[model samples]
Target: MTAARAAGAHADAVPDLVPDAAPSAAPDAVREPAPVTPEAVAAARHDLYTDGITACRGAFGAEWADRLREDIEAAFDEARRRPGGAVGRGPHRYYVEIHPEQMRGFAELADHPWVRGVCEAVLGPEYAIVELGFDIPFAGAVNQPWHRDFPSPELTRTERRLTSLAFNVTAVDTEEDMGPFEIAPGTQWEHGDGFEHGMFPPRGEFPRYESLAVRKYPCRGDISARSALTLHRGTTNHSATARPVLVLGVDAPGAGNDAHHDMAVTRAYRDALPERVRAHLHCPVVDELAPIVQKHTIEGLVMGDA
Candidate 1:
């Protein structure tokens, strides 16, 4: 199937998280929505993410949104910021990095039952974060490249089962041309044995996968959640305005790449995970706060790196 389509082509009431072989509910009927069990949540996430693309546009609340925007700006003004912490790899876009406290601001935004429902349905309660990268509209462009996300299991011996969650919040209505995301659905299930990066190594490297239209969720706060190992990309933002978002790559307690080694702040975030979660993430865990990762794109006033 469609890999549990969320927020588009259908009414907002219908959850795309339902399986293709789902037995209950009439074609037109929205069933008595059931609570997602940890196992089912994991399975549905797997089913939904096998191709690796889902969107939860507008999932963050209004008040929460404004506050986060401010935090991002402030964080950007500071030093020690990594352009794209987790989700984004290179610069097809612009971004504002926020601190953990600012990230926590959106934590409560999950107060809405619908948001929590989606979280429960996809990640359940055992989830731990991999990294959070916030994006702001670049002065004149937008879009993502073709790529596949790897689960934590492949990167480290410690974490073999990783469930990743990501969200892209928009501040404006993304009309067809304003800015959209492009994706290949159901690629998460693809075996990576023979695949290679599309642009790397000079060896005909390419992310092996499919291309579907990026999911467009309704209103502010709608979100797309999924497991990792999905291939995806973003549509170039043709809009003169900006498309701001927070990209969180969360994995089942202990999934992370080794590249994060020795970063105090990143390690602190990793260390904060539950003991069990720590054991699952392959990255080093530290108790210290990370160095200031935010460096301003504007004025040269230096905010010393932590």
Candidate 2:
């Protein structure tokens, strides 16, 4: 796997790509419910702290993934119907942030033992769910500039403490021509000088990132988490299929990312959620679900490379 290979070259390589034991024989195999052990949490924490990423293969069954995909397609259709509903992320690529109620598996995803364990392990026990969204790159989507999701926090740049993390769940099995997500392990710690908006590195820095980059091919039911500060990009998609992946953002207290997102749920939905799940959500409980006006400030991605 890329994690193992990258770890060999970079001492800070991720060791927790397979958080549990080896992945099941089938990509869609339903995992029996089990408790997340201290050892698993410790390994996941180490991977996040060192390589800035970790993953668990086949975390959910294929049926669940299919349902999530159906929900995403419905949401995408709705978002595309309205102006400013889907934010452009370069040609043929769009990003949409949605309310928790928009997804049928919101609670199941948020309350999953592995997801909970990783958040608590890395961001401490008080981590908050701040964002729920998806990125869809269709055919003709151009390559994105190598960049971090956002600028590093002051604590991360100075005190070396990571305060936030992004978890991704792909809606379909990934193919190379579909524009696999690529990331440079350990570059999250690189506090470089020539970054546009403190997120995108200059073209001159591309070669360095390219040399270290590893393309990820996550299948349905797979989940990966990474520091949003890591240098990464979406390669050009040459296939006809659109690659849609769910993004869940979590933050440690004082991370301040919740300010940039408007993740909300209806009062009825909130009332139905378990207390543990409610504890992680920092967004508001409103009577209605409003379409989120995309507020992500990565303007460089609006026009991808030619």
Candidate 3:
């Protein structure tokens, strides 16, 4: 069964992190009426708070997802050839941060009502789009250490508020062998000493994360949002085919995630974007888009282990 169809079969199995399937979206529904109900926004906020993640199945369509894969492949090829463009997550896994204009469906993905509603609810109305990227785990990619994308910010540690979010859209139907993403529900609240670079929790903490882990099988067109501080990792990929997923990062004002990324737009591309969409991108408007020179490399991940 397609992931969307399989969601129901597994919903009862994962009560806390089960995908909240939205209404079946038409081909153009992603771009239609943008207003979102307060109830939906409240539920999304609640899920993020309780589970540290949430998802909407079949947010777009298979065709739209295929287009995303095509764009990702093209960008990955170009990044592979440039020094520092593609950073290694493990032996066979890579992460590349690209400009929004690099992808054809970026605007659609960013402007979707679900995306907007979640951002508004969790990060506030002035949330900024700070990063656009993708992660690919090819054959031979090994299980990653349980870790957060970064150290929990002060707001999260002291005030118990999430300051940033990461939205992921798998470019293909994820299966058991493709190193499906795994996350430990509610681990975003855990923070203590012994974390390397304030990201990877020490191996002593692995057992708890493993016991609480839920392997996510998000199909093409499925989208999930999560606090970047959540404890999670990519499992080993035994399939020969690579699994690539788009990553869009948003931050509340003063989150400081923008300092880690170099997201830019050409003057013309910036001019063409809807004001509502453009308002979220806080980056330099350049005369010409320059090939990004990656500066924020995760040292712990570069060695394939912590």
Candidate 4:
């Protein structure tokens, strides 16, 4: 089936979008039973709209979390062993995209109900996965400048609304010293060349916004959903180990035609996934997955040249 048709089939299976507010309940009331209930979906939608991001703790169980962590570590090792496997964009930042086929354990998360619910609420029911990769910042890696995932400074506020969402899953417990992900709350609404440049102004120029940046320390299994336009950065990793986070991009139908980060999985793998999951992955399926290698440097990382 065509990619668009696949996306439509996937959308048809999603539950109806929920309202922005849940039923009134006391602060001490009992919690909902389901992991992605209508109430939970509504609250997540509200946060994404108001704060530009939502952090869902324990979104996945310990079993899934443990498997993903192990797979990620194995992928890292494999990448390093392969010729030109590890691409260094900076002192300690390694760029790698673990093909979905190789990391099936983590790839299945794309079809998890809770994940689909959030994507449906934020990017509409017709959303599709445009890219998936691993972002590993090892010890001594420098902080990344604040930036947006896409460049579209000319789009109006309404034009940019919910066009794409980024779902990040941490592979390990993110501690303060680990240089967790940080973001400027509510900055997703800001538009213009300054915010669209894909890199923020120097700290001296925007001290207040820089100072207001909040650090997010999410434990393993936590999922963070945010607009692709949000102002955020990956902080420096000071610990002895590497910090690897899985990054998945879901875009509203027709929103990512010009995206540069498109990825492809093997045909066998694509055919193996359930129809529900296949719909989200609309990219081409190749006969064999190839290694992605790129030059790495601090300047390249800051400029996004890599």
Ranking by TM-score: 2, 3, 4, 1
State the C-alpha lDDT per candidate. 0.42, 0.81, 0.81, 0.65
Q: Give each model a TM-score.
A: 0.56, 0.88, 0.87, 0.78
Against the true structure, candidate 4 has what lDDT? 0.65
| Candidate 1 overall lDDT versus native | 0.42
lDDT per residue, candidate 4, 7-43, as tens digits? 2433222111111232222222232225678788888
lDDT of 4 at 20: 23
Which is the leading candidate under TM-score?
2
Q: Which model, 2 or 4, shows the larger TM-score?
A: 2
Off by over 4 Å in 3: 1-36, 304-306
Q: Each candidate: how many clashes?
A: 38, 0, 0, 3
Residues 1-306 of candidate 3 have per-residue lDDT tens digits of 222232244332111111234322335454333235777678778989999998877778778887887788777666655577777787777788999888999989989889998998899999999999998887778898888888888889899999999999988777798789999999898874578888988788899899999999887787899998889999998776678899999999999989999989998998898888998988999988888877656767766463
State in Å the error of residue 5, model 4.
45
Two-way TM-score contest, 2 vs 3, winner: 2
TM-score of 2: 0.88
